[model samples]
Every structure is written in C-alpha cells, then in structure tokens.
Target chain A: MADNETLDAKIEALTAEELARGLDIFRQKLGAAGALWLQTCVHCGLCAESCHYFLTDHEPQSIPAHKLEQVASAFRGRYTLVGRLAPALTGARPFDRDLVRAWVDAAFGRCSTCGRCSLNCTTGVNVPAVMRAARATLTEMGLIPADLQQVVTTALETGNNMAITREDWLDTVQWIEEETQGAVNDPAARIPVDKHGANILFTVNPREPKFFPLGMQASATVFYAAGEDWTVASEGWDLTNYGLFSGNNAEGGAIARNLLDSMDRLGCRTLVIGECGHGFASARWEAAEWLRERPGFRIISFLELMEDYFRQGRLKVDPSRLTDRVTLHDPCNTVRQGGISEPQRSILRRCVTDFVEMTPNRAENFCCGGGGGQLAMAQYRDRRLQAGGVKAEQIRATGARVVVAPCHNCIDQLMELNREYKLGVVIKTVAEIVADALVLPTITPPAGEDHDVTS
Target chain B: MGDAGLRLGVAICAVLAAVALLLQVVRTRSFGTRPPMAEAQGSALRGILYAFGPGMAPSAKESTRTHPVVYALGVGYHLGIFTAFGVLVWSMRDAAAGSALPPAPVRQVALVLTALGMIGGISLLVRRARGPLLRAISIPDDYLANLLTTAFIALAGLRLLAGSLERALLVGAMLLLLYIPLGKIRHCLFFFPARWNLGRHYGRRGTFPLRH
Candidate 1:
C-alpha cells in the first residue's frame, strides 16, 4: 500500500482529463438526497463532537461539516448561480486537484461514514451521504487508498475480498463443521453446502474462512442447536462487499447479483447474512437498490435470525454458562445505519448473565474506527487507531472483561485497539458468546419412532 | 423613500424570493430521488413524524444537549423570523384596508417574541464569529446571511416597539428577501425536506422512531 506521500504524488499527477471524469462521476452520483444534504448543512458545528475522528484530534478539518465542505464546495461551484458568479462568497471551488486531494483525505482517511454526525446535525444533513458522493468521485479518479482498492479489486476478480478459492473455502467450512459436531456432541450436526430447498442460505465474510474460522464454527454450532435447515453456498458465500466501501455501484451490484443467483440456485427461503455489519447492510438494505431488482427471498441479519430462534423457542441457552462481564460494541452500519439494533441486544440478554451497557449504546454508540473499509486501508491504520480512542474509552468505562462486537470488521479493529490501548479485554462475536451458552435439547425417541434417524 | 415606495419594494422582493425559492424546490426535485427498491421495515410516515416532532427535541440529540443555549437561540431566532413575517403580513393587510393597528395585546406579544428573536440572532451571530468550530465551517455567505437576518429581526422588533421604523424595517426585509435564494438562507426551504429525507432513509431501515 502506498503511503500518504506516494498517494499525494499520484493525486498531484492526475491529468485534466482524469479530473473531468471524476467531476462527471461526482455529478452523476449527487442525486436528490445528496443534493438535499449538501444544501441543508448550516455549519452549526454541533456535529463536531459527534464524530470520533474530530473528537480524537479536535482538528477543524476533521469536523464533519468541514470534511463535507470538500464536496459541497464543488457542488456549489458547478450548480449554483452565486457560486458561478462569485465563488468566494459561497466558498465554492472548482473541481481541481487540490479539492480532490482534500476530498480524498477527508472522505476516505478521516471519515468512517458512520452516520453519527447525521443524527446530531442541527439541519438534519446526511453528512455520510455527501461524503460517499465525494468517495464515488475519488473512486472514479482512481484515488482510492491503495490497500482498500486492492480489496475491492480482489472481490471483483475472485468473488471474495480475501480471494479465497473454492478449495480453501470448502476446507475451512468442513473444518468448522467438524468443530461444530464435536462441540455439540452430535454426529448429525452438519454445515450443509449448496443444499437445495434449504430454509436459510447463510453467507459469511471472507474473513471468516481466511482468518476467523471460529466465527463460522460458532454460527454453525448455533444453527445446529436450533435444528435449522441452513446451507452455505459453494460460491457467492462471501457476504462482505467492498463495493459498499469503494462507492462503485456497478461492482456492488455485481456482487449482490452473485448472491441473488446463489439464493435462487439453492432455493432458500431466506438469505441470512452472517455477522458482518457492512455485509448485512449491503445485503439487507442496499442490494436491491444496487441490482434494481427485489429479491424473492427474505433478507435478514444472522442476529435477527438468532433472535427469531429465541422467540420461537427453537434454541435454548443457559446464560449461567458465561459469567464474564460483557459489553456490546454496536457496529455503526448494523445499528445506526442498518437498524438491526435490538436483535443483537435481545440475543445477548438471553445468552449472557452479566451484561453491561456502554454509556452511549445502540444508535448513539461510537464507531470502532474500522468501518468504511478502514481495516483494509493500511495507510490509515495510525489515524484509525487514534480515532478509536473514543471507543477504547467507552469500553474501558464499561469495565467489562469481554466485548462482543457482531461485525468482523469491528472485531478486528477492537482487537487491535485492545492491544494498542492496553485495555486487556477479550473481543468475541455474538455467535461465539451464544455458542458458549447454547444448551442442546435432549432428544428422547418417541417410542422408537425415530430410532433409525440420523441423530 | 416614501412609505408607498418602501412598501412596494418589500412586496416585490417578497414575491421574487418566493418564486426563486419555488424554482429551487423544483430544481431540487428535478434531481429526482431514486424510489427505494427494498422492502420497507417500518413506516416512513412514522419516521417523518419523529423527525419533525420528538426528534427535534433537545433530549433527542446530543447536539442540543451539549449546546442548549445555542439550540435555544436557534429555535428562538427561527420563531422570531416567523413572527416577524406574520407581523409584516398583518401590517400590510391593515395598511391596505385603512384599519387600526393590531390589538394592543397582539402587538405586545409580537414585540416580546421579536425581541427574544433579535437577541437570539445577535447571540448566534456572535457565536458564529467567536467559536472556532463554527468559524472554520462558515463561509462569507454564512456571515452575510446571519447579518441580514439578524438586521431584519432587529428592525422588525423596532417597528413593533416604536412604530416609526417602518421604512428601515421594509428595506431590511427587502434585502433579506432578495438574498434568500442567493445564499445559505435557502436552507429555510431545504431544512424540512432534508429532515424528511433523513427520516425516510432511516425509517425504511427501521432505525428511526428508534426502538429501544
């Protein structure tokens, strides 16, 4: 990955033609909602405190409104009468290299697109949407952070961000399936692959197979305990979408289409997105918009599915099995943006005995500083960790020994923050915690009726 | 200028402002929002109600809680602006009809509200200039907009108290109305829609009307 200096040199080398193309893409992406947000900002500065990046450094440039000014300035200069006549008065600037450089840093380096500022904005400006427009523009200019762009390129080329092959993915799944069977003490416990007519088509972040296989094992254990008819696709199994972060709708649409095709192929009743915040958001919220086609199957988060299982009494969990003081780190995409706030809380309450709430939990919770592909952008690692000080403090204040963050991206960052800040805490996923508390139901054969069954 | 000429100037500026703002609304709509293709998990209406209702309450957002005085000043400033507009319309009607001024109680209430608004406007303007965060985000248009509106509010209050600054007040109103579509003052029109858009986006995701 290129450092900031190299990236700056590349940005400086942008040709006039490239800048024009970027501006054209910017105009195309600034639809009504983006226009509204750009126009509505009142510069009240109240949003300054709501942003983790701004709070970390108190730099004026880090302020959400100031960060968005990069895009707003260009929008004004191009579209407005006063801006055309007297750009200085409105702070409008032409779409030039300087603006692009500022935009790349502000939109990609500083912001997580967490939407926390939107909630606090006095005029209700959707700050993140405007930032995304800036990102879309930069993406076209080929100015995406090198590592981040690589992730997107990897996904586009190999069907998963990690570029895991069919062989490797199958190997990981089989390994987790065996682990699930051992943990559940049932030979019939299975992680089915591409099984037709399955009730749920479970998808996972490529990170699960490439690095964090325990998350897969945990999910499989829970599904087995609930006796779910679930299958992981042999292809299109990676739920995480880099397009969401890359701001490339076409690429995002392609990824979403692959999942839709996989669902159709398996004939699943539902598409249960695994514990990836942006992945859940990409599938449940943005996929249809990207594809311009409504999915035939129900799209839900794995957390929501777990909540449903608890509600239906299909899964029994002994909360007493886990006694560690636990606090939940709400992923911004899943809670604040995706609206899957309560389900995870519901699942946690049922799966843990000592649960503590972070001071500002739920939609107001701070970002773990790894959203918007920050984890993938190695160039921004220091800035990301610095901005994560807020979340680190939130966790420390909770005094919890264990932190449960449902999203893999967040888990990765939080784990780093734990080491960086020396917070001395274990980070686990909701599925992992629930797996610990899972109580397998005793199956008493009904007068030898099921004596020869798989169990 | 003569009384008649001042009144006519104010009227023309108001009309032009309205037409310009309407055109802006059309232009904004011209960018046409993509109809959400996903299945909605909650009612957009419910979310919109929350956005305009409880969502605006100080308790509902950290911004307001942290800056209660600034929020109050903003609220008062807007209220005063609305009240000044009402008084302007009432004065125009009475003048055209050759009738007496508003009842003393109505006049007094208007005076009090406009006075609060005038103070809010001045205070906010000062905050904008003094506060580093606000100053950094502000452009020339912001300060100009605040100045024009604050001046208009002050003149309106003076007209209510002394009933002699009608010409000055009319000129202030005319300048403000003319500047509305040319600067950040247009946010007066975009605020509601922006809030609506925010609500609808979150509502569709079942995030707003926030469930506990």
Candidate 2:
C-alpha cells in the first residue's frame, strides 16, 4: 500500500493544463456522444459482476460499475453541483497515478468489453462507453500501458492484431491449405483471394493465420466441401480489431471501416467472420453501430454460416466423424452480443451424435476469459481462467469430453482451462467438426497427373 | 381541463399502452430474448422488493457502492417523480385548480420530486462523464437517460412555473405510460421483476442468491 502512494503522488502531480488539453481533445472528438454518457448514469450497479476482473478477483473496485464511478464522479465534481454534493457526501476521492494504472489494467486488460453488462443494466448506462472515454483520456496523456502500446504499434504496421506480416499471413494460409489437403484430401480446394462479387467474405483472426492455423485449415476445408463462393481480402481485411481491446473506438472504427467498405466495393452479400468472440463482437456490434449509418452488410459467424449451409442443404452432415460426447460453450460475444446461438446448436446436432446442452447455452452464456480482448491484454492471464471457473463447472456438469466452442477466443481460453482443471475435456472449434463431417463433391481436375490436392 | 379532459387523457394513454403491449407481446413470442431465457421480470421484481426491504444501501441488485448521497438522492428523485405524478393525476378532474393530473399543491410536490431526481441523476452523470474509467466506457444511452430524465424534470418545473397545467399534465401522463414501454423507463417496472426472477433461478440452482 505504501508503494501505491508514491505512484499516486506522481499521477496527482500532473499539471492541470495537461489534463485539460487531453480532455479538450476528448471533448472535440466525442461531441454529443460524450455529453450523453455524462447525462445518463443512475448509479445502479447491476454491471459489477459482468466484468471478469471483478468476477475473478471479487474486488469491487475492479467491477465495471465501480470503475465507471471513479471516472464519472470526477466528471461530476468538476461539472455539476449535485455531482459535487454526492461525491462530497459519498466519499468521492481524487484520482491518483495508482488508480489510473489499476484502472488501465482492469478496464483495458481484464474486461472483454462484451457489452453484456450494458444490456443487463437497468438504466442502460453502457460501462464500456464510459471506459472508452477514460481510455482516450488516458491514452492522450501518454499513460497507455506498454503491452497494449506494442499491440497498437504492431497492428498499425502489420494490419493484423498479432502484428503478423503480410508475407506471414499468406504463408500461414498456404500452410493451412496444405494441411487441409492432407486432412480432407483437397489440395486444389482453391481458397478464393480477393474474389470480387463473391457471396461471402471469410475472415480469420491473425492468430489463426499465425499460431493456430488449424482453425483456418478446418474452416477452409468446410467452406470448400460445402461448395462456398467465398473470398478473402488480400489487404486491409484483417478483422480482429485490437483498438477494441483498449476501448479505442476510433481505431476500432478505422480497422472495421475498411472491411465494411471493402465488402461494399467487392459487392459481397454477407460476411463470414472467423472464430473470434470480441473480434466478432467488435466488428459486428460496436464498429458497425459507429458507421454513422448502417453499412448494409450482414455478418454471420462461421458457426451460423454452417448452420445456414445445413438448413439450406448446401452441405450434408455426417455425425460419425465426431467420436466423443460434446457440449456447446457459447462465447459471450457470440451468444450475448451476436445472437448466433441457434446455428451453433444446429451445427452440433448435424456434426455430433452425442450432444448435451450446457445450462446457460445462449444469451446468458458465460464469457470466455479470452474474450473482450482479455487474452490480448496479456497481463490478466490467471484472472481470465479463474474467472472462467463458473463456465468450466457448467461444462463439467454436462459430462462431455469434447467442448465445442464456436469462437476462437473461447477455444483459446478453454484450451487453457482444459490443462488447468484437467476436466478430461478437449476443446474443438465448430468449424473443425463441420469440416470433418461435411460431405464434399468430387473435385474435377484438368488433364492432371497423379499429383492432385483436390479430392 | 375538466373531468372530460382528464378522462380522455387516461383513455388515450390506456389505448397507447395497449398498443405497445400488443407489439411487445408479439415480439416476445416470436424472437423473445435471443436464445437463453433470463428471468428478467422475476429478477427485477426481486431486486426492487429487496431494495425496499433490506434495500442494500446501493441496492443489492447492483454491485457498485455509490455514494449514499447518490442513493438518497436517487430515492428522493423517484419519490419526487411519484409525488409530482400524483399531483398531475389530481389535476385531470379540476382544471382551474390546476389542469390534468393534480392540483397546484400536488404539482408543487411533483416539481420538488422531479427536481430532486434530476439533481441526483445529473450529479451521477457528471461524475461518471468526468471521472476515470467510467467516462471511458460510458455510451450515449447512459448520458441520454440522465439528459432526458433531467429534461423531463426541468420541463415539469418549467411547466408548473408557467405553462398551462393541463398541457403539462397531458404530456407527463402520456410520456410516463407511453415511453415506459419503449425506452429506459422500462427499468422502473423491470428492475424489481427482472432481479426477482434472476434471484429465484439462481437460488433454485444454488447459484448466488442476491442478498441486500
């Protein structure tokens, strides 16, 4: 606690002028939206436990509601008389460096910005919106935590969240294509690239193209086998918006704006987002809302895409390929924010014979530790999994060995939970199952020799 | 301004509410709450009831420990709205004595309530907008809730201070009954019921029972 005071002093000592300048920029950028958030808080704390930081740590300060108060009260004290009275009456304290740093960690790193808390809040006070304003204020002050700084720099330079180079992105896709051929015997599967006017534009998180290419491999094989007229963007198409991780909506908007406009330019009908929870949430939810007007493009998750394929008879399913009993783990963004759970159920029903339902399967789905950019933050690793204990227990109750999460973030966190708890459960991507079980049409080759990747 | 106006106003409001309920009822049946069923009505009722009883200073349904000033202010504000609304109701029968809902004395009380509620709400809003992490996460709805609630209160005060009591009464009643089903006002009714249902389900499952 003594160490905390030193840092607090350092933060408090910042000139009011500097703080004012940052606030000025925020005011200029925020305009009416800023005022709206300032006017709406009713002091109900329903959003407290929705935060992973608060849930895992059980710290009131970490709760999204409390965090909002810290920033909100300061705003109140400076601007409104009643706000002043409440703070004075209610122990409104001043901000210090320690509080700022802690807030950075909790709001930016620990919480996934899933917007679940906002949905549940009675007053409709969006905590993430307040958190983003605070984030911009902090960011302007050059107080952004180093790790997130690194991610932003990487993303700006590489056009991917993990900062994968363009060459690496292509190479990763190539490796996945090869693996797809080896696994599904479809080398000439021909994953379309920059194919304008395609019906679907499939996108993956940079992680899929970097470390876990298997997810990409699975999705590619599934799309090909299902005879999808899908294409991927060669430039500015990386959909995982890290700006969302820091609650930086502008950068998030910038990241997603390209894809939305790209879809328009390419004349695509729908978007098949990859297996990312926050990426899916950020791209499909917040960023789209910020487009000033609706972008007129519809987004469907890969799982939902699979569900549509089966419902439309675009793909024939064979459940025999999936050998174990499986239960569905709905990623919060995919379920709570995305509203894409039925397709998940449909995919499971078509791909696995031994299927069981988790108690909270849909909108009330527990968040994966990796969602809301919690995984990207890199500091809250333990809290991410520990906060996920409730979710693990839900799965355990199902008595299923294979846990199929339709999200990349869920898959990542579930993988860690599998090792930590040793629940004897293996996590599988929905894409993996759908691809393995999907019936594919015979691949026709030109006058080719025995060397053929497409089966 | 007289019994006729008052009767007509309530009838119109009742009709509007019926229409809103019909739409919501239809929507609830078709799509409902996307996927997982939450005990929103049940939980909200429980939360509100618990609030009245043990009334976790800041309310147990909420986890944040707001300033007691804020809580008291909130209670005061809601009470003001309630009283102000009551006065307006009385106005419907006696036009010159007042206009729509209640008399001058009753409207006065409503004004006070609206004022108090606005003070507390605006206080909280300003605090969050300028404060640390909250201002960061605050979206438009958050500010808009306070902005509109305050506006309604200010407008109530203005109308009482000047405008025809009947006009104020009609607008107030229509807004309360009509928008309650549409906007954030849904919380007043939803808070208790939603929290109650959530508590029941969680309790049955041996999940966390929300205690004040």
On lDDT, the leading prediction is 1
Model 1: which docking level applies? medium
Off by over 4 Å in 2: A1-13, A25-52, A84-86, A90-102, A257-269, A288-298, A441-455, B1-212
State each candidate's clash count.
Answer: 0, 72
User: What tens digits encode model 2's per-residue C-alpha lDDT throughout A1-455?
Assistant: 33234334545777767655654554543333333443344455556655555666766566666666666555544443434554553324345444566556555655666655654454445456556667766666666555665676676666776766767777767667677776666456667777899999988877677667777888888887777898887766677776766656566677777678678778889887888776776676667545544557677677778777788888877899787889988787666555556778877888888999886556555676677556654556767788778677788999998998877777878888888777888887888778778777665445644654543
Off by over 4 Å in 1: A442-455, B97-100
iRMSD of all candidate structures: 1.3, 12.7
**Residues A1-455 of candidate 1: C-alpha lDDT, one tens digit per residue:** 34677778888898888877777788787788888788888787889999999999999999999998878898888887888898999999988889988898899999999999999888889888888878877887778887887887888898888889999889888878877766776657799999999999999988888788888989998899888999999998989888888888888889887789899888999999999999988998888988888887799999999999999998888999888899999999999989889988899899898999997989999999999989988888899999999999999999999999999999999999999999999999999998999888665545735433322
Local distance difference test values of all predictions, in order: 0.87, 0.63
User: Which has the greatest DockQ?
Assistant: 1
lDDT minimum window of 10 residues, candidate 1 chain A? A446-455
